[model samples]
Target chain A: MSPLLEVRGIGKRFGSVVALAEVSTQVSAGTVTCVLGDNGAGKSTLIKILSGAHRHDGGEYLIDGDPVRLSSPRAALDLGIATVYQDLAMVPLMPVWRNFFLGSEPTKGRGPLRRLDVAHAKEVTRRELLDMGIRLRDPEQPVGTLSGGERQSVAIARAVHFGARVLILDEPTSALGVKQAGVVLRYIVRARQRGLGVIFITHNPHHAYPVGDRFLVLKRGRSIGEYGKADITVEELTRLMAGGAELEQLGHELAGYGDVTALDGPVKSEDEQP
Target chain B: MTVGQDAGGPVPAARVRGMLARPEIGALIGALVVFVFFASLSEVFRSPAGIANWLDPASTLGIMAVAVAALMIGGEFDLSAGVMTGSTAIVTGLVATRLGWNIWLAIGVSLLFAVLVGFLNGYLVMRTGLPSFIITLGSFLMLQGLNLGVTKLLTGTVLIRGLADVPGYHSASMVFASTVSVFGGAFRVSVLWWIGLTLLAVYVLRRTSFGNWVFSVGGDVRAARNVGVPVVRTKITLFVTTAVAAWLVGTITILRLTSIQANSGIGQELIYIVAAVIGGCLLTGGYGSAAGATLGALIFGMVSQGIVYVGWDADWFKFFLGAMLLVAVLTNQFVRRYAEEAKR
Candidate 1:
C-alpha cells in the first residue's frame, strides 16, 4: 500500500537562512518514522511545514499519492494531519473534556440556537482516552494537573480521537525524564499499532530506537542519513548521532596529555572508535 | 487498586469533590457573605421591594459584568465598554429626538454603531497583537471624545434631551426601561433582561461549544489554534458581544431618564471589570463563570444601595468600592494560587 503521507524534495527558507533544504521522507501506517536531530537542526521547521503552519517554498506533499497544499493548520487538520508539539498542545486551566473538545466541538442545533452538548463531549473524552489505555484521575480536572508524560499521552489520544491518519509529534519526549520518555514511547507504539502513521521527532536515539521503524537523521537542516530499523543497530545509530570522530577527538582532548592514570582509562578502544 | 499503586490512578469522583474543596467554594462563600451583610443592614434589603430596587442596578451591571467576565476569562479587556454605552445612548437619542427618526430605527442604528466599535476593538487588538488594555484604552479615549464632541455639536448642550417626545418613545421605554410589578413593588424591565441575559450567558459558557472555545482561547491561544480552534473569530465575536451589551445598557439608561449625557457611562468600565474579577474570572483568562459575574454585580448593588439605607454618607461609596475591588482581587489571587497548588 502507498504511504499515508509523502514529502518530496521539500525546502524552506527564512529570509537569508535556509531552514530546510530538499528534505524528503515517507510515513506509512502502523510504523514510527523517527526524525532524529539536535537543536536547530530544522526539526521544528520541518514539522511546521508538515503541519501546515508554514508553506514550503519548494516541495511536493502527497496524501495517498495526490499532490496537496496545506495553506493553514486548519487545512492540515481537515486532511487528517495532527501535530502535537512538545508543550502537549492544551490549555492548562480547562477540564480535560473541554480541552479534548476545544476546536471541533460537536453541536446539536442547526444555526444560532445551536449549543454544545457537554454530556456527549464528556462521554466521548472518557471513552477515547480509555480506548488509548490512558486513565485520567478525573476528566473534569484541568489538564495542567496532569504530569508531563500524561499530558503528552492526552495530546496523542486527542489526535487519535480526532481521526488523524498521520500523527506528527514534535520532540514529544525532549523535556521528559527517562521513565516519562519511556511512557511516551509506549504511546507512540500504541498509536502505530492502531494503524496511524506516526512521525516521532526526538534528539535521543535511545528513546527512538525501541519503537522506530524507520530512522531519518538530520544535521544542520539536511538529512544526514536514513536507515531502516533492521539496517541500523542502536550502537551505530548513537555513534553517528553523536558525531563519532568529533566525539572521540573531544574525549581525547579532555584526557590529560600523556598521563596514563589521569586519562581515566584507555584513550581509544579498538571497537569504540571509527 | 491499592492507594499506593493508585496514587496517580483515576479518581472516579474526585473532580466534583475537588471543585467543592477549592476556589469555587471561596466564591460561594464570598457571595453568601455579601448577601447576608446587605440583608442584615437594611430591613428593605430583605423585602421584595428592596430586592427589586437592588436587582435593578444589579441587572444592568450584571449584563455588562457577565460580558466583561467572559472577555477577562479570554485574556482581554474592553476599556471602551463603559463609555461605549454613553456613545451608543447619545447616538440613539440624537437620531431619534433630533434627527426625527423612529425610536426603534434609532435604536437599531445605535446598535450598529456599537457593533462597529466592538469590531474595531477586536480587529485592532488581533491585527496589532497588542495588549487589549492599550488598544481598548485608545478606543475608550476616542469614543469619549466623540461622545462629548458629537453630543455637544448636535444638541448644542452636554446632554441630549426630548427623547420622551419621539414617536414610539413610550412603548420603547416601557419595553426597555419601564417597571414590571413582580410582587408588590415594580421591578425594572432591564432587570428581566439582565436575568435572561445571565441565563443565556451561563448556558453559552457552560453547556455550549462556543463556551469551550472561550475557555480555550483564553487559556492558551496558541494551543487552541494548534488544535484547530478559530482563535481570531472567537475573540472578535466576544468583542462584538461585549459592545452589544454596552448598547443595551445605554438604551435602558437613556430611555429611563429621557436624556443622554456625554459622560453618562464614564468610569463604569472598571466597575464591570472589577465585578467580573470578584466573581472568579481570572485576569489572565481561561477560568470564570457568568453566574459568578452576576453574583458579583449583586454584591456591588447591595453595597451601593446598602450604604444609603444604613444612613452613611454617599461620598463614602467610592472608598467602599475601592476596598471591595482590592479585597476581591486579593481573594481571587489567593483562590487562584490554591487552585494551581491543588492541581499539582
Candidate 2:
C-alpha cells in the first residue's frame, strides 16, 4: 500500500543554526513510525514542520502521493494531519465535551440563528472517548483533572474522531509514569489498529520497540540511523542510542559489582555466547 | 464497545457539585440572601413599581455589565466604556439638536463613531499586544477630555441641552427612554431593553459557536489558535459589541434627560466591571455568564435603592457597596480555584 505521508530531504533552520537537515521518513497506515531523539535533537523542529507551524527550508511533503504545501496549522488539519502535543491541546478549566469540540464546534440551524449542539457534542465526546477505551469520571469535569495518560488518550480519541488520517503524537508518554506510559502505548496501538498512521515520538527505545514498526533515531539535528523491526534488536538499539562506547564503559565500571562466583561460572559462558 | 464493558459510563454529578463547592457559591448564596433581605425589609421592594424602578438602573447597568463581563472573560478590560457613553451621547446630542440632523440619522452617526472607537481599541490592543487596561485607560482619558472640551467649545457650557426639540425626538425618546405601563405601573422601556439584551447576550455566550471561541481564546489563546480559532476576530468583535452597548446606554441617558453632561459617565466603567465580577466572571478570563452579570447588576440596583427604602443613611451605601464588591470578588476567586481544582 502507498504510504499515508512522506517527507523527502526535509531541512529546517533558525537564523544561522540548522535544526534539522536531510531528514526523510515515511508513515504508513496501521503502522507506528517512532521518531527517537533526546532533547535538542531537532525532534520539535521536525514535528513543527510536519504540523505546518514552521516551513521546511528544503523538502517535498506528500500526502498519499500528492505533493502539498501547508502554510498553517489549519491547512495541516484540513489535510487530515492532526498533532497531539504533550500539553494535549485542551483548555484545562473547560468541560471534556467543550474542549473536545473547541475549535470545530457543531452548530444546528442556519446563519445568525445557529446554536451549538451541546447535547450532541457531549454525547459524541462520551462515545468517542469510550470507543478509545477511555473512561471519564465526568464528561462535564474539567480536562485538567484527568491523569496525563488519560488526557493523552482523550486527545488521541479526539483526533481519530475528527477523521485524522495521520496522528503525530509528541512525547505522549514522557510526562507519564510506568503504568501511565503503558496505558498510552495501548492507545497508540489502538489507533494503529483502527488503520490510522501514527508517528509516535519518544526517546525511550524499550517504549518504542514494543509498538513501533520502524524507528528513526535522531542525534544533533541529523538522523543517525533508521531501522526496521527485523533489522535491529532492543539491546542493540539501546546501545546505539546510549552510544556503544559509553555503554561499554558503563558496563566495565559496573562489572566490579558482579558476584565473582557467578561471573566465573556458566553465566560467563552465557554472556559470551550472546 | 460492548455495553457492559464500556468504561465510560455516566459521569458523576460531583463535577457540578465541585463548582458549587467554590467560594463563588457563597457569593451566589449571598446574592440570594441580599435579595431576600431587601425584599422583606420593604413592601415596595416586592411591588412592580419598585421592581421597575430598580430594574431600570439594572437594565442600563446590565447592558454595560454584560459587555464588560464578556471582555473580562476574554482576559481584557475596557476602562473607557463609561466615558465612551458620554462621548456617544454628546455625538447624538450635537448631531441632532445642534446640527439640525434627524434623530435617527444622528443616532446612526453616533453608533458609527462608537464602532470606530471600539475598532481603535481592539486594533491598538491586537497590534501592540499590550494589556488592554493601559490602552483603554488612555482611551478613557481622551474621551473624557473630548467630552468636556468639545461640549464646552460648542455649547459654551459643560452640558448640552434642547435635545427634546430635535425632529423625531418625541417618537425616538418614547422608544428609547419612556416607560410602558406593566402591572398598573410604568416600567422604563430601557428595563425591557436590558432584559432583552441580557437574554440575547446569554444566547450568544451559551449557544453560539462564537461563544465557544470566546471561552477558548480567553482560557488559553495559544491553544485556541493552535486549534484554529479566529482569536483576533472574536476579540475585535467583542470590543465592538461593548461599544454598541455603550451607545445604547448613552442614547437612553441623553434621550431621557434631553441633555448631555460632559462628566456624566466618567466613573461608571469600574461599576460595570465590578457588577460583572460580582456576578461570577473571572478577571483572568474564560469563565463567566451574561445572566450572572445581569444578576450582579440587579444586586447593585437593589442595594442602592433598597438602602433608601429602608430609611437608612445614604452615606452608608458606599461602604455597603465596597464591602459587597470585596466579598464578592474574594468569593469568586475561591470558586474559580475550586472549579479548576475539581477539573484536575
Candidate 3:
C-alpha cells in the first residue's frame, strides 16, 4: 500500500524567510515516524503544513497517493488528520468528559431536543482513559488539575477515539518528567499498534529512539536524512541533533574555565578544615 | 488497563465532593444564607404578599442577570445591557404612543433594534479584538444618549406616557405585565417568565453542545477554536442573548407602568453584573451558572425590599451589594480552586 501520508520536497516560506525547504517523509500505517529536530529546525513549519495550519508553498503532499490540499485545521480534521500540539488543545477549566467530546460531541434525542449525551460522554471518557491505562479519580474534575502527562494522554486518547488515521503529536513529552515521558511513549506505541500513522515530533532523541520505526532529521530548513531503525544508531542521532562539532567546541571552551589551581587549593585535611 | 496496581476509579464520596465543588455551590450557599437572614429579621418578609413584592424586582433583574452570566461565561461582557433596556423601552413607548402603532408592532420594532445593537456590539468586539468592556461601554454611552435625545425628540418629554390607550395595549400587558394571583397575593407574570428563562438558561448551560462551547470559549479561546467550537458565533449569540433579555425586561416594565423614563434602566447595568458576580460568575470568565445568577438576583430582591420591612435605611442596599460582590468573588475563587484540586 502507498504510505498513509507522504510529503515530497514540500517547501514553505514567509516572505524572504524560508521556513522549510525540500523536506520529505512518509508515515506508513501502524508505524511510528519520529521527526527529530532542535528549535527552529522547521519541525513546526512541517507540522503546520501537514496539519493545514499553513499550506506548503512548494512540492506535493499526498495521502493514500492522492494529492490533497487542506486549507484549515477543520479541513485537516475532516480528512482524519488530527494534530495534537504541545498545548494539547484542551480547555483547562472544563471537565474531562466535556473536553473529551468538545468538537464532535455525541448527541441523543432528535431535532431541537437533541443534546450532548452527558452520561454516555462521561462513561466513554472513563472507559477510553481506562483503556489507555489512565486512572482518574473523577471524570467530572476540571482538566486543569490533571498532571501534564495525563493531559497529553487525554489529548492523544481523544484524537484516537475520534477516528484519527494520521496522528501528529507535537512534542508530547517535552514538558514531562522521565516517568511521565515513559507513559507518553507507551501511549505512542499503543496508537501505532492501533493502526495509526503516527508522526511523533520531539527534540529529545532518547524519547524518540525507542519507539520510532523510522527517523527523519531536520536541520535549519532542510532534511538531513531519513533512516529506518536498522540504518541508524541512537548515538549518531543524538550527536547530529546537538550539532557534534559545535558541541565539541563548547566542551573545550568550558574546560578552560575549570581552573585546576583553584581546585587544588580548596582541598583540606579532616581536622584542618575547621 | 493496569489500574489494579494502585489507581482505581473515583469513590462515591469523592464524586459527591466533586459535585459540591461546582462553580455555583458557593453562590447557592450565599443565596440560602441571605434568604434566611432576611427572613429572620422581618415577620412580613416571609409573608406571601411580602414574597410577591420582593420577587417582582428579582424577576426582572434575574432575567438580565442570567443573560449577563451566560455572556460572562462565554468570556465577554455587555456594559450596554442596562441602557439597551432603556433604549428598547423608549423604542416601544415612542412607537406606540407617538407613531400610533399597535403595541405588539412597537414591541417587534424594539426587539429588532435590540438585536441590531447586540449584533453591533458582538461584531465590534470580535472584529476589533478589544475587550468587550470597552466596546460595550461605548455602546452604553451612545445608547444612553440616544435614549434621552430620541425620547425628548419624539415625545417632547424625557418620559413617554399615554401608552395605556395604545391599540393592543391590553393584550400586550396581559402577556408581559399582568399579575398572577396566588394564595391571596399577586405576583407579576414576569416572575414566571424569570423562572422559565432561568430554567432555559440552566438547561442550555448544562446539557447542550452550545453550553459546552460556552465553557470552552470562556476557558480558552485558542483551544476552543482549534477544536472547532465556533467561537465567534457562540460569543456573538451570547451578546445577542443579553440584548434580547434587555428587550424582555423592558417590555415587562413599560407595559406594567404604562410609561417608560429615558433613565429607566440607567446605572442598573452594574447591578446586573453584580448579581451575576454574586452568583459566582468569574470576572475573568469560564465558570458560572444561570441558576446561581437567578439566586443572586433573588438575594438582591430580598435585601432591596427586606430592609424596608425590617425598617433599615434603604441606602444600605448599595453598601450591602458591594459587600456581597466582594464576598461572593472571594468564595468563588475558593470554589474554582477546589474544583481544580478535587481531582487529585
Candidate 4:
C-alpha cells in the first residue's frame, strides 16, 4: 500500500547553514516510524518542515503519494497531519477538559447568549480519554498535575480526537523516566492498533526499538540510514544512532576507566584500523 | 467529577482540596479575616452607613480591577488604565463645557476616545512584540501630559467645572451618579454597576468561548497559536475592555462631583493591580477570576475606611495596604504550593 506520508530527499537550509539535507522516510497507517537522532542531528529542522513551520527547499513531501507543499501549521493540521511537541501545546494551569477542547471548544445557545457547553465539554473529554485507556480521576484537575507520561498520552489522544491521520510526536520520551517512557510507548502501540500513522521522534534506541516498525537515523544534517525492523536489530540500530565507528573508538579510549559495555554493540568487529 | 484512585470511588479529602484550589480561596479567607478584625475594633466599620461609604470607593476600584484582572489573565497590563479614567472625564467635561455639546453626546465622544486609546495600546503591544508594561507606561505618561496641557490650554484652570448645568446633565447624573438606598444607607449607583459587571465578568470567564481564548493565550501563547486561537484579537479586546472600564469610572466621577481635576486618577493604576493580586490573580497570568478581583477591591474599601473609623492616622493607609498585599501574595503562593504538593 502507498504510504500515508512520504518524504523523499527532504532538505532545509538557513542562509548559508544547511540545517537538514536529503532526509528520506515514509509513514504508513497502522505502523510506527521512529526518527532517531542525537542533538543537532537535524531532528528539529525535519520536524519544522513536516509540521509546516518551515518549508523544505529540496525534495518531495507527499501525502498519500500525492506531492504537496504545506503553507502553515494550520494547513498541515487540515491535511490531517498533527505534530505533538515534547512540551506540548497544553496550557498547564488549565483544566484537562479545557485544554482538550481549547481552540475548538464546543458552545451552546446563539448570538450574544452563546457560551461554552461545560457539561458537554467535560463529558466528551472524560469519555475520549477513557476511550484512549487513560481514565483521569477528574477532568477538572489542572493538566500540570498529570504525570509526564500521562501528559504525553493526553496530547496524543488530543491529536487523535482532532481527526489526525498522521501524528508526529517530537521527542515524546526524551524528558521521561523509563517507566514513564514505557507508558507513552504503550500509547503509541495503541495508536498504531487504531490504524493511525505515527512518526515517533526520539534519540533513545531502546525506547524506539521495540515500538518502531521502521527506523530513520539522522546524524548532523544527513540521514545515516533508514531500515525496516526486518533489516536491523536493536544493537545495530543503537550503534548507527550513536555514530557507530566514533562510538566504537570512544569505547576503546574509555575502556580502561569504566565499563564500555554501554556502547558495546553489533558494530563490525573486523574494522580493526580505526 | 470523581476524585479518588484510578479505579476507586470518590474521596472526601479530594473534594476539600478541590475547593482550596480555587483562585479566590485565599482572597475569601483574607476578606473574612479583615471583616472580623475591623468589625471588632470599630463599631462603625461594620455598620450600614460605614459599609455604604466603603463600598462606594470599592465600587469604583472594583470596576477597574475586574477589567485589569481580565487583561492580566489575558497576559498583559495597562498602566494607562488609571490615567485613562481622567483622560476620558477630561474629554467629556471639555466637549460639554467648552463646545456646549449635550452631556450624553460628550459621554459618547469620550467612550470612543477610550476605545481608540485601548486599541492603540493593544496594537502597539502586538505589533512591536514589546512588553505591555512599557507600552502602557508610555501611554500613561503621554495621556497625563495631554490631560494637563489640554485643560490648561482651553479652560485656563487646572480643573473642568459646570458639567452640572449642561443639558441632560441631571438625567445622566441620575443614571451614573445617583445613590441606591440599601439597608437604610444610600449607596452609590456605581456599587450596583460594580456588582453587575463582576457577575457578568464571572459568567464570561467561566462560560464563554472568548474566555477560553483569554486563558489559552495567557497560559501559553505559542500553544494557543498552535491550536489556532485568534490571540491578537482576544488580547486587543481585553485592552479595550479595560479602557472602557476607565471611561465608566471617569463618567461616574465627573458626574458626581460636576468637575474633574487634572490628576484625578493619577497613581491609582498600581492599586487596581494590587487588588487583582490580592484577589488571587497570578502575576504570571492565565489563572484568576473576576469575582476574586471584586473581593480584592472590597478588601481595599473596607481597610481604607475601617482605619479611619478606628481613629487611625490616614498617613498609615499606604503602609497598611502594602503590608496587606505582601501577606496576601505570600499566603496565596504558600497555599498553592501546598495544594500542588498534596495532590502529588
- The model with the greatest TM-score is 3
Write the residue-wise lDDT of candidate 3 on A23-60 in tens digits.
99999999999999989999999999999999998999
Give every candidate's TM-score on chain A. Answer: 0.87, 0.87, 0.91, 0.90
Error in Å for residue B273 of model 3: 0.6
Specify the poorest-scoring 10-residue window by lDDT in model 1 chain A: A262-271
Worst 10 residues of 1 chain B by lDDT: B1-10
In model 4, which runs have C-alpha deviations exceeding 4 angstroms?
Answer: A9-24, A57-59, A219-225, A259-274, B1-17, B41-43, B335-344
Candidate 3 deviant stretches above 4 angstroms: A12-18, A56-60, A67-69, A258-274, B1-20, B338-344
Q: Output the number of the DockQ-best candidate.
A: 3
**What is residue A102's positional error in candidate 2, in angstroms?**
2.0
The residue-by-residue lDDT of candidate 2 on B1-344, one tens digit each, is 11222345333644454655332354467668887998999988879888787777888998999999888877789999999889999999999978899999999999999999999998899889999999999999999999999999999999999988899998899899998988976799998898899899889987888988888888888888877789999998888889999999999999999998989899999999988888888889988878888888888888888888888998988898788789877877766665565211
TM-score of 2: 0.90
Candidate 2 residues lying further than 4 Å off, grouped into runs, are A7-24, A53-61, A66-72, A248-274, B1-28, B342-344
lDDT by residue for model 1 (B44-86), tens: 8778898888788888899999999888877799999999889
Q: What is the alpha-carbon lDDT of model 4 when measured against the actual structure?
A: 0.89
- Candidate 1's displacement at residue A117, Å, is 2.1
Model 2 DockQ vs. reference = 0.31
* Residue range B72-147, candidate 4, lDDT tens digits: 9998999999999999999999999999999999999999999999999999999999999999999999999999
Window of ten residues with lowest summed lDDT in model 2 chain A: A136-145
Q: What DockQ do you compute for every candidate structure? A: 0.34, 0.31, 0.45, 0.38
